[model samples]
Every structure is written in C-alpha cells, then in structure tokens.
Target: MIDADDVRRIALSLPETVEKEAWRMPTFRVAGRMYLTVPDDETSIAVRCPRHEREELMAAEPEKFWVPPHEASSAWVRVRLAALEDLAELRDVVVDSWRQAAPDRLREAHPALVPGAEAAGGR
Candidate 1:
C-alpha cells in the first residue's frame, strides 16, 4: 500500500521539487508553488486537481479520491494512499500535479515529464 514514505520518494524524485513543512505537514513544491501536501498521520495526500474534473474523479472512486471541506472551493483533491493501485498510478498523479504547479518555462524544459506535452504537440 502507498504510504507517506512512498509519497516522499515519488514527489521528491520529480524535477525541481522540494519538500517543505507547512501547517505541520509535508508539502511538495515545484518552483516554490505547492503541488502536493501530506497531512499529519499520512493517511492521504492532497494534490492539484482541476475543479472541473474533481467531482467526476470523486464520483468515480470515492474511496480513492475526496475533498476536504476546507479545500472544497479550491482546485485540489485528497487521495487516500491506501487506495492507490501501484507506484505507476502514484507517479502519474504526482506528475500531473507537478505539471499543474510548474511554471511555463519549467514545463517546457521538461516536456517529456509533463503529461500531454507530446500529445498536445509540445516538443
């Protein structure tokens, strides 16, 4: 099962990522903007999720995805670590969040890592 250590390893392995403590929790940032946060006790991880897609994701997998009341109005979603299927899925989620938070320059520089970069015709 995915856990805090798994989150730490995956998140920190990404490009330009840094781990910092905020609100007594572990936060992963890309170019200084927060992309992922692992709350105390580490049952789950919160990451950048487009608001338009959040509800559908939650509906699709309630056990895996959720919205913390405080974050309901924002473009973020919490994912239960235990619900993840494997490291590949975790990497995908983390990469997507990282792409969403990364600057244009960073994204461009790391097109191979950003989801849909090649699909979107980005080289």
Candidate 2:
C-alpha cells in the first residue's frame, strides 16, 4: 500500500521538479507552479485536478479524497494513500497535477506528455 513516503517519492519524480515550503508543508512544483503538496500532518497529499472532476471524486470517495479549505476550491483534491488501493490511479492524479502546474509553453513543447505519456509506464 502507498504511504507518505510513496507520495513524496512520486511527487519528486516529475521532470524539472523541486520541493519547497507551501502552506507550511512540502510542495512540489515545476517551473515555479505547484502540482502536489504534502499536508501538515503528512497523512495526505493534494494534487491539482480538473475543476470538473473535483466534486465527483470527493463524492465518490470521501475517505480517499477531499477538497482543502482555502485554495482552488475545485482544482485541488487531497488524497489519503491509506484509502487508495491502486497506485496507478495515484500516479495519474499526480501526473495530471504536474501537467496543470507546468508552464503552458512547456506543455505545448512536450507533445508526448500532452497525451499523458507517463501513464504508459506507470505502476
């Protein structure tokens, strides 16, 4: 099963990534944009998600996902690894987050990733 370490590892795996302080927690970013963040207690991690999917994800899996109190209302969902059985899903979440946070020009330049290249080899 995935855990805090798994979350940290996955976030740091993104290309041209770096970790820094955000909301008093460790946050991962690409080109200065946030993609993933470890919450204060480290029990969960928040990832950037499509605004459309926010409610569905939370309603469908309240124990696994939630919307944080004070940021991007429908664009971020905090996920608890203890409630997630599939690591692939977690990877997809993080990848999507990465894409959202990546610079628009960088995304335009990386055609392969635009279609989610990371999903192909993810576990």
Candidate 3:
C-alpha cells in the first residue's frame, strides 16, 4: 500500500513540483499552485479533482475517495493511501492532478506528462 513517503517521492518527481509543510501536513504544488496534500498524519492524500468528476469518482470508489467538509466547496478529493490499487494508479492520479495545477508553460514543456498531447509519450 502507498504511504506518506510514497506520496512524497511520487509528488516530488513531477516537473516543477515542490513539497512544503503547512498545518503539519505535506502539500505538493506545481508552479506555485497546490495540487496535492497529505493530511491527517499522511494517512490520506488530497488531490485536485474537478467538481464535475468528483462526485462520480467518490461514488465509484467510496472506499478510496472522499471530500473533507472544509473542502466541499473546492474542486478537490481525498484518497485513502491504503485503498490505492497500486503505484501506477497513484502515479496516474498524481499526474492528472499535476496537469490541472501546472501552468500552461510547464504543461506544454512536459507534454509527455500530460494525458493527451501531440508530444505525448510517457512519464
């Protein structure tokens, strides 16, 4: 199962990503925009998930995802580390969130990191 360290490793691996601690938790950001956070002692991770897809994701994987009350109005979801299927899934989630927060320039430069792009290759 993925743990806080795994989260740290995966997040920092993203282009232009950085990790900072706030409120006693690790938050991951791309180009100064936060995209992921490990809270509650790193038991789970909060990641960007557009409002349109958040509900469906939670419904489809109730055991793996949820929205913290404070973040309900925001486009974000929390994932239970212990529920993640594997490292590949974690990487996909992290990369997706990174794409959402990454600036246009960063995303464009890292075309392979983006899901659908002319330069798309592999991360």
Candidate 4:
C-alpha cells in the first residue's frame, strides 16, 4: 500500500524540493513554499490544491480526499494514502502539489513533471 515513505521519496525527487519540520510533522517544499505535509499519524497527507478543485475532489472521492475544519479556509487537501491505487498515483498527486509550490522557473525547466505532460510529448 502507498504510505508516508512513498510520499517522502516521490516528493524529494522533485526539483529543488526540501524536507522541513513544521507543526510537528514533515513538510515538503519547493522554492521555500510548502506543498505537502505528512501529519503525525502518517496515514494521510495535506497537499496544495486550489479551494475549488479541492472541494470538487472531496465531493467526488470522499474516501480519498478531505480537509479538516481547522483548515477549511486553506487551499489544501488531505489525501488518504491507503486509498491510492499505486505508487504512480501517489507520485502524480505529489508532483501536482509540488508544481503548485514550485517557482515558475523550476516549473518551466521541468515540463515533464507537469500533469498530462507525457501524453502531450513533454519531457
């Protein structure tokens, strides 16, 4: 099953990503902007997501996505690791979040990391 370690591995593989401690948990950042966090339990993760998309994701897949009340106003979503289909899916989600936090220069340099890039002949 996908787990926190998988999240860590995939996140760290991104360009300019760093692991930092915040709120007593591990937060992954790109260009100094946090994009993913593994909470204390390590069963799920919080990742950058626009509020509109987050709501749509949660509504479409309640078992896999959600946000706590305290973070309701934040543009982030919590994903249950166990609900992921495989490492590839985990990588996709992590990379998407990484892109959100990554600076424009980095994103431009790493076009392969952008969602749907492979199908569009990127990389």
Please report how far candidate 4 places residue 113 from its true position, in Å.
Answer: 1.0
Tell me how candidate 4 scores on lDDT.
0.87
- Go through the candidates in order and give the C-alpha RMSD of each one to the true structure: 3.7, 2.9, 2.8, 2.4
What is candidate 1's lDDT per residue for 1-115, written digit by digit as tens?
A: 7788988987887778999999999999988999999986899999999998999999999999999898899999999989988877887888899989999998888778854
RMSD of 4: 2.4
Give the per-residue lDDT of model 3 (tens digit) for 1-115.
6888888887898888899887887899988899999888678999999988999999999999999889999999999988988877787888889999988988778778853
lDDT of 2 by residue, 1-123 (tens): 777677677777767779998668888999988888888777788888777788888888899888767765557888887787776667767777888888877667655653235554432
The residue pairs found clashing in candidate 3 are none
lDDT of 2: 0.76
Each candidate's TM vs. the true structure?
0.90, 0.79, 0.90, 0.92
Ranking by TM-score: 4, 3, 1, 2
Error of 4 at 116 (Å): 5.1
Q: What is the lDDT, from 0 to 100, of the residue 63 in candidate 2?
A: 91
Instruction: Give the per-residue Cα lDDT of candidate 1 at 21.
Output: 96
* lDDT of each residue in 1-123, candidate 4, tens digit only: 878888898788788889999889999998899999999699999999999999899999999999999999999999999998877678778889988988999988987777544423433
Consecutive 10-residue window with the lowest summed lDDT within model 4: 114-123
As for candidate 4, its clashing pairs are none
Supply candidate 4's per-residue lDDT for 26.
Answer: 98
Least accurate 10 contiguous residues by lDDT in model 2: 114-123
Better of 1 and 4 by TM-score: 4
